[model samples]
Target: MKKTVILGTLLLGLALGGNAQTKTPVGSIGKNDPKAKAILDGVSTKLKSLKSLVANFVLKVEGGNSKVTDSQKGTVYVKGQKYKVLMGDREIISDNKTSWTYSKDVNEVQINNVDQSGQSMTPAKLFTNFYDKDYLYRLIGETTEKGKVLQNIELTPVDKSKNIFKAQVDVDKKAQTIVRMKIFEKNGNKMSYEISSIQPNATVADAMFTFDAKKYPGVEVVDLR
Candidate 1:
């Protein structure tokens, strides 16, 4: 008798899920829609004003139904093609020509020139020229999260393999920012990033993107070219 009840409950749940999925309107399902367009415009407007931004954030992640938290304090410098991410006593610098990742723990730095693809959190790429880039966009349906309104958009690279997520990205519309990002890999591993306490236009220096070899005495430089 108990087994029968459980099976009935499961069947009912599936029925409800199917109904909800079919109920969503198709007009808001991709980019160029009124709501999604406004969202992209708002995000662009917010990014254009930011010359350089520094923010201290804590990442809250849920892996395997368990909650894990990590704190990252960093600064981003956006001066044309030059960009840098300084965090946790380490720094990644792209000096408009060559890029290097400096690590104090391993006592070495990695250097590469003209490797400006598939990396995240790039101020110049993510900010100034976001919408202008060649991305296939869709509305991604309604904007709601946990019963609240959130900007939702789906983006796929023109080249299928370039984008890890392939399916879509959920954006928070009212905040004009990315609430969380998800990347689905073929091997059943999904990487997620939730943004918090992002302060834009914070006072940052251009020197932050410069790599001074003399400044660091002993370090290993790994060039991944």
Candidate 2:
């Protein structure tokens, strides 16, 4: 369940890579700002134009009562509906049919059916148009970070019952892509995922998104499907 929590935190940030947990259907939160919509549309267009994508990111988990902060560097390979996320000792792989969650520390892999119920945000939808129905977004303006102009967009989930109440996405103005994402949860936790590097139209194989037990010696498979 710790892995699920981490994945939800990761994917929810990426989905807001525009943002996951399941909740009631959203009602109209407010009118979507035209400026924000156009910026997000550009990101969607840029993503759809790619054949495959490889991105290196850093996820920084902070807040809570603890004074310490945990940071993990991860790589994500996405091709169509398939994706493989490698973060720390855990790897989350899905082929749009079956999902695999592998934890290296335990040397075990958990398999489950990929739920395409549109209730949760999958990796494939990370760079797509998921914000349209889920949240109301507004452009919060722009700032220059190390010479790169960044556009900031604030998103509020229409479904109040969701764990995450708000999210902020920082876009690279010239590239029209998400550079960083920060989410504020109802539990007083703040998570930030910053894209360190991105490769559009990267060369990636389909095999990367599936769990091959043979690759790991003495591994245990737990199929929950």
Model 2 C-alpha lDDT per residue in residues 97-190, reported as the tens digit of each score = 9999999999999999988786677667766788999889888767676777777788888888888888888788898888878877788777
Q: Which stretches of candidate 1 lie over 4 Å from their true place?
A: 1-35, 57-80, 87-90, 115-121, 129-134, 143-148, 222-225
Which candidate wins on TM-score? 2
lDDT of each: 0.50, 0.77
TM-score of 1: 0.67
The candidate that achieves the highest lDDT relative to the unseen native structure: 2
Q: What is the lDDT of candidate 2?
A: 0.77
Give all TM-scores, in the order shown: 0.67, 0.87
lDDT of 1 by residue, 1-225 (tens): 121111111100000011122123446333344555567677767766766554433222234444333334344455555666655666667766677777778778878675446333344555543443545565655544556455456555554554243434455556666554444334443344444456566666777777788888876667776
